[model samples]
Target: MQDYAKLRKAVEMQSNEMKRIHDVHIDYWKECSMFFSPVRGRFLLSDKNKDFKKFHNIINNTGLRALRTLVSGLMTGVTNPARPWFRLSTPDPSLRESYNVKIYLEEVERRMRYVFQKSNLYNVLPQCYKELGLFGTANLNIDEDFEKVIHCTNFTCGSYYIAQNDKLEVDTTIRRLNKTPRQLVREFGLDKVSAPVKSLYEKHNTEGDVSITVAIMPNEDRDFGRAMDKENMPYIQVVYEDDAPKDKVLAVSGYHEFPQATPRWEAVGEDVYSISPCMEALGDNKQLQHEEKSKAKSLDKMNNPPLVAPASMKNTPVSALPSGITFEDSQSEGKGLRSLYEVRTPIGELTNDIQEVQRRISSALYEDLFLMLANDRRSGITAREVEERHEEKLLMLGNVLQQLNNELLDPIIDRTFAIMARNNLLPTPPEELQGVTLKIEYISVLHQAQNAVALRAIERSYAFVSGLVGLYPEARHKFDSFQAIDEYGEYAGVPSKIIKTNDAASQAQKAEQQQQAQAQAMEMMQQGAQTAKDASQIDTEKLQELTGA
Candidate 1:
């Protein structure tokens, strides 16, 4: 029911573009093209350029050209306009990292050709005489419906697409069967099957009109022998043919198709034919599904917010403290305690708000940086360029954040500590202090944490920006929300508490002990209001008379 053709084309287009890059990457591996090596330097293939070139030329000259000619001639049983047949293999993830495109291609073709022939056998044989079916196995005298009989082939890769008529679906060269060779030999007997049985029980046979073969022609240098085996492993081949005969036929020699006794043998060629018109139509339908899925995925990410702090905290206000001394500390006994109260309520709100702003900005930056790194993986952007841009942006952001820290947070932090020190709330100084302390250690910790938040934000911003550019390098200007933090802007004033003096030790002790007193006071106020409400429930005149109003 699926339009496999369109899907195939979409996959083809996308894959081709990706494959071009992959092919370039292949060349890159041989030439040591990439700057950053994820696997360090050991396994990279820089020294094998000359060997790879020679290897490719050998296949193009011999095996592939012959295979193409053979495929064209064998299609409709006559040699004419030959349709070009490309190589295919099992979809092996492990093999991709160490892909031997040339050798793997040959092995796949060979196995596929073998599987295709066997698959055709079921269709040509009479239904009653078909030896491969479930019904024929149980009863040798049953009538078989060749018309109703739909032959199926279980390929080495377990892909059913080969059974279809429209497309050539090939998988990577990774074996999907779980059974071990010994287990297979004990169960299925390797002697009964073909010679190049890498593992036992791996049934490499053809069920339908599809051509399946174990394409194996390893080159000396590129073969990599045991190493390549560990990487791609080998896969079984399967093929099917819908137009083959439906009635049983007499037994024939498997090797009779290829008359040559030598390894360099030729296959019978058939007439070339264009793909069926019906199959072309199927390709269109599959393309639509791929587009819809891609669009939906894009929308989902757009709708989601950055995974971080609450929305309310995204924006924060700058500080604006009045230049009044109404609450100025005068009492030496209350110096340290004065700092807490000396900072006006509005100023406190402003400072908290500003801190939130800094936090958000920094977070955004860090996220941007991470996104950039991600983009580089897909966008062909070099890591060095991304890093360079990241450094520039980070320096700019750090400067702004540093300036803001100095102008806004620093002063408030200084004032707060001064108040704490005066009230004896801070730890006793190693030495008696008279003038402005070099640094307020308490605020310094908080400041350092804030700085970290800011620095990380810059990192994130770089990541996000890099990703945006990678995804849409040509149109990245549209995402202006990722504005640089270094743009010149007026800074908000620092918030500060009134400078007051107090009995440092006594006030510090009282603040600790009187925390319970504050709670008690609040409770008393609640009780008083409750009592007043109860008294007010009585008539107003009676309440007024009782209180001698």
Candidate 2:
């Protein structure tokens, strides 16, 4: 029973402004869905199960298929749930070698992997990827679950409205949830719910779910320097009945961090919402749909055309089947039943045109960029050619990868870590490193793909330097072979245990040098003793006599 009037007003006014821009996004997203994700979002609760029949106008299905490929590429390349994709490290490189620091990080990584696997993060990530590529933005909610350690939910695009701070980070989210009265009573408890909803729950009403709007935003008025409470936490979540009286709130809660992660593919100038890859080919998709429809109609007309019949045969039946019999006037010789006119569909050119459009649409979505490596079946495709194509893709995906890191992957890790730490689920860290800021290093397949390019460069340089050694042996000394080995191992995502630290390597080299020095000294001593023995055997006296001394 907290008075959240002030906070509620802020959400309402901001939501109105958000709605205007959100509507603009809806217009574009709806068009994109016609060919890409036809039934993805509820979209104002317009209808269900009808999208495939109504707006799914693609005859080639190339757009829909390309969307799937993009999702798979992102999942495997960015954050493959099946494999360990990210590592934890301190900002200070020197601390990374500390046994305590290294051990703590390893334990943390292990726990994180376990939690993500135990949760449904991987199950819902594909839909999040699809929404990002199709709508230019997507939302993911991460919360703590006592049973699962962590929980994740992916919200359909356009179903929620979002606002950002000056830094363009999403700090506030308003979502319209459809929940049954029984669900609401079970979730927030009957005492905290609205009377109408409570009555339904008590009466066992079988009516449909109620639409409730919940807003999570920054609690700016609280003193962040002090310990956080539900009222004084960093972010507040308010749930109010939709279309009910003002201040008809169901529940008010808070969180230590913003739980929603809104990852955008690419944002336009000063716009909160993003413009997706789907928009690039929207024109082509619409035209392709039109062309295919026209082709179908033309073929139908060519096969089943309107008939021309004389009045004498107006009452007669005409069978249009393969070989049908029709009784016509016995004396009618001029005409019986004939086609109204000829239909030259020109289906050949039309088909080719449709294919060209299909190719264009696929290219717009960057389908060829990903499929080239896996789908190419041509002979004589060299490894160098594949590497060059991979490099090209890396260069093109540079901005996209960076954005995903900044907006998606980074936030998810930070939020998950925060939740785990609060529940005391992580391992203890070194006393000195408690206040140290940790950084995330992405080793996902996508990131390694980028690193793979650098690996090639390093190897090529090493080979070139080695080739020069025979001509100018000093060239070998100029190359930092030790540093090169370390760099190569890192880029390959080789575990630290497999690669020795610099200190260990330097010590090994020094020990080897000392052993060589000892061996050389021992050899010199042995040779000196042998010479003395020869002298003792009177070789010197024999030499002097031969010299007539």
Candidate 3:
């Protein structure tokens, strides 16, 4: 006996609470998106085409180009589609290096990449990243697809509502989506949907899309000791027609993990929503547009200034068109459509100001920082040198990148791994690695810059030790060579197969030492036997001399 009313009430309460805080951000987000991104805002029915048709406000396209570059830069720096930018490892470094675990994790990484490539992840990811830049908060749903192995759906900021737990982690996701009647029935089936939805479906009333709410929240009854199934799992999903009776749920299901990843760039204290660089630079964006608009008007006046005519020629029509003769009075010869106030607009200075504002907007969005690698014109510069050149930028983004790893990439990979494991698409883990938890290590370009600090430390330490080795060769004993090798391998992105596990390396060392010990003992025994033979010959000669033979 599922309490449909209770479930609906809980979902509505959570959603209402989320929307209460979320509405404040929506007001500004509407303005922000209008200027930079060309995408239409689909938050409300009234706001549908209102924001959609307002792209004319963007008199300058600098913001648009900067945002596009921001998206591409993020893709290259964080999760490059062309490379395996992340890896799976256990918390125990030694465990990660074990041959079996290493092979299994590699297989897992390979499979996950395949799934990502097959799915719409790479395509929709830019949308998510774009929303993140524009709104500071972005939601992406990672779900299972039988054919694709994994499926990704990105929700623009205002279209969704989310609640955070006590730890400020988003565990509740409520999406207000518009689905056609046919879509509802196809998804939940005829018998599962509400009466209103079914009526429209059966009558072929597909005239317009109807709004529905889907809620993903904690299953409150899981603690009541009910048998665990899809419906009774830890987190539950409830989808229902918004206009249907409040007591009926369209569909009910559950997930072992939170399938939605909601990432916020700069979350203020205790707020569910976040503020982004778009919001920060929105003032400059508007100023830039205004400046550009003013410049256009100035140019317009210069090209076609307003005209004034004398009373004598008031009856005659003025021909402003090109190659048209106006019967302007021979009396109005000096006043025949001449320049108005000499049209003095400083075109060069206005352009300089507009460019300055555009540069400010780009800086707010970290455009220069993100595209530092792409913008570099240096020849023969290694990746490390480029990273070193922009190390400060990476440090600036350190906090955001950490949050991105936790809020976005972590859950995405975790959900995909779960789907693959559920479908038996992965190899079984070794018994030794049975209980060890898998962790994701981002080795992307941005993360490499973060690790470069530690790598530099290692390099400096080795250089110091090399200098001291001639004077104090035993100073090498202070640092553990094996641990240094392990860390270097990890930070250097060395393949796991290239490095042996700590246990394996230790065992090999012990075997070599045992062989050396055994050979030394055998040599000592042979030397003693040779000396004994020499003593025996001396004894024989002495005895012969004493007997006078």
Worst 10 residues of 1 by lDDT: 256-265
Ranking of models by TM-score: 2, 3, 1
> In model 2, which runs have C-alpha deviations exceeding 4 angstroms?
45-56, 224-227, 327-331, 376-385, 529-549
lDDT string, candidate 2, 29-98, tens digits: 8888777878776577434445357444567678888888889888877888878899888787677667
For candidate 1, give the lDDT of residue 517: 92
lDDT (10s digit) by residue, model 1, range 1-549: 213233233333443343333343233232211111111111222221223333332211222222222222222111111221222222432222222432433443344334324333223222111111111010111111243221232221011111111221112111112223444344445453333332323454322112221211112122324443321223212211112132211111111011110100111122111121112222222233333344444444444312332334334332224663333234333332111222123434444554443333323223344345446546886534544556654443344334323322233233333333334444433222223124321122112323344455566776787787877796556543312322100010011111111233347768988998999999999999999999878898887999999
**Model 1 / residue 405 / CA error / Å:** 25
User: What global local distance difference test value does model 2 have?
Assistant: 0.82
The TM-scores, one per candidate, come to 0.15, 0.91, 0.88
Where does candidate 3 stray beyond 4 Å?
46-53, 317-336, 502-549
**Steric clashes per prediction:** 89, 0, 0
After TM-score superposition, the amount by which residue 247's alpha carbon in candidate 1 deviates from its true location, in angstroms, is 24
lDDT of 3 by residue, 444-512 (tens): 877887888888889888899989987998998897878888898788677788888888899999999
All candidates: CA RMSD (Å): 39.7, 2.9, 5.4
Task: For candidate 2, list the clashing residue pairs, or say none.
Answer: none
